[model samples]
Target chain A: NAGVTQTPKFRILKIGQSMTLQCTQDMNHNYMYWYRQDPGMGLKLIYYSVGAGITDKGEVPNGYNVSRSTTEDFPLRLELAAPSQTSVYFCASRGTGPNTGELFFGEGSRLTVL
Target chain B: AQSVAQPEDQVNVAEGNPLTVKCTYSVSGNPYLFWYVQYPNRGLQFLLKYITGDNLVKGSYGFEAEFNKSQTSFHLKKPSALVSDSALYFCAVRGGGSQGNLIFGKGTKLSVKP
Candidate 1:
């Protein structure tokens, strides 16, 4: 089973351009998240959704937006991308249980902004 | 605010040697800690988690982590390292009321050389 699927494994965008990173999970999880990984910064949360039709801003939400219109999909949108936004993006999902803190991640989407 | 720290930026070890990647966390309440590994150009994969019960949590690929609540550390350990185990390892934490959001460490690059 495809646990989590992400689109555009690699992409390049010019400054001020916009694009969307798509994420879908077959695990039927209630929680989904978008994170960006910089060279030495590990991962920073961009946005998250607890369930369908619900979304919230994460620690580093600037220049980005997210929507959760269904349980299986959560997409992150980049508006007027900047050089600082050029990083590897990952989407993750997790279920609610005793060990709910563990996250299953996608293969990642590498974006470069020039 | 909860946070995680992976003290070492890079760890190198010969194959068949025991390996340890140190991690420490700070949280106001009980902490749910996790370890994830990332291969080159890939996404983060859940390695293990420490929620409660046993301080020693065993996980995939012969990797385990010891949770020391008193020291606020959750260090990942492997009895014998393999060349294939080389990757970036991340430590994460979720505190009370985090709503499943995790704070990740800066990550440690482990290279198990042959």
Candidate 2:
């Protein structure tokens, strides 16, 4: 299986630009998450979904939106990108087990905002 | 709230030497802790996790972590370090709620020199 897959391995966006980071998982996991990794900072959760048609805001949800249209897909949207949003975006998935199961992450998409 | 802490910003070690990356966590109920590693320009990979039993959890890449409930710590350790082990390590705690959200630490960079 492909596990967790993310698109746009690299991208450059100008201030006020908009884009979407697509994430798809073949693991059929019930939980999906979007995280941004800054240099020394580990990662901050941007958004998450428990299952299809369900979504929730994470620690750093500003300027970002997410929708879980299907169990396999959860895309993150940047309405008005800024320089602060320039970081590596990682998508992860986990099975529906309480207090169990580790997250599986994608290769990550590096975004540079100028 | 569930939270994780990697006390060290970075850990340095020479090849064949023992290495340790410190991690501690806090949560209301039982804490489900996890360790992840991120290579250069790559996503975070699951190293190991502690759910219930087994204070010592072995994971990929000959890495292991010791879970100490008394100290609320889950530190990653390796008997012998390798240059290839250089990477960023993260500690996370699963939110005790049913949603199973994750809270991550700022991360610790492990550098192994030959």
Candidate 3:
């Protein structure tokens, strides 16, 4: 099964540009998340969804927006790209069961803002 | 706020030697901790987790972690390291809540030399 899938494995953007990073999970998970990994820094949460139509901001949600219209999809949108946004982005999903906290992550989407 | 910390930026060890990656957490209530490994250009993979029951939680790749309530630390350990084990390790924590969002540390680079 494709636990989680992210589109556009790598991309290059210019300042003030806008783009969407698409994420999908086929495992029927109830929770989905978006995280960015900067060099020498661990993953920083941007946004997350507990279930369809229920999204919330995470630790570093500035300059980012997310939508979860379906249980299988959670997409992150960047309205205006900046150099600081040039990092590897990861999408993860997990079930709602208390015993099922292990997150299944996508390969990653490397973005470069020049 | 709940958070996790990986004190070391990098850890080096001989291939056959024992290895340890230190992690500490700060939270108000019982903590649900986890360890994940990420290879170059790859996504994070779940190693193990500590919710309750035992303090010594064994995970994939022969890795284990000890949860110390007094110290508020969860240190990952392996008896014998392998060169193939060289990667980035992350420690994460989730507090008591229905929301399944995890707070991750900066990550530690594990370098196993042959």
**Residue A84: error of model 3 in Å?**
1.4
Off by over 4 Å in 3: none
lDDT of 2 by residue, A35-87 (tens): 99887777888988989999998889999999998999999999889999999
Q: Give a tens-digit lDDT track for model 1, residues A8-105.
A: 99999999999999999999999999999999998998998999999998889999999999999999999999999999999999899775778899
Output the worst ten-in-a-row residue range by lDDT, candidate 2 chain B. B94-103
- Which scores greater on DockQ, model 2 or model 3? 3
For each candidate in turn, the TM-score is 0.98, 0.96, 0.97
Candidate 2 lDDT over B1-114, as tens digits, reads: 888889899999999999999999988988888899988888888889999888999999999999999998999999999999999999999876556667889999999999
Ranking by DockQ: 1, 3, 2
CAPRI class assigned to model 3:
high
Q: Is candidate 1 or candidate 2 better by lDDT?
A: 1
Native contacts kept (model 3): 0.76
DockQ of each: 0.84, 0.70, 0.82
The deviation in Å at residue A109 for candidate 3 is 0.3
Candidate 3 to truth, TM? 0.97
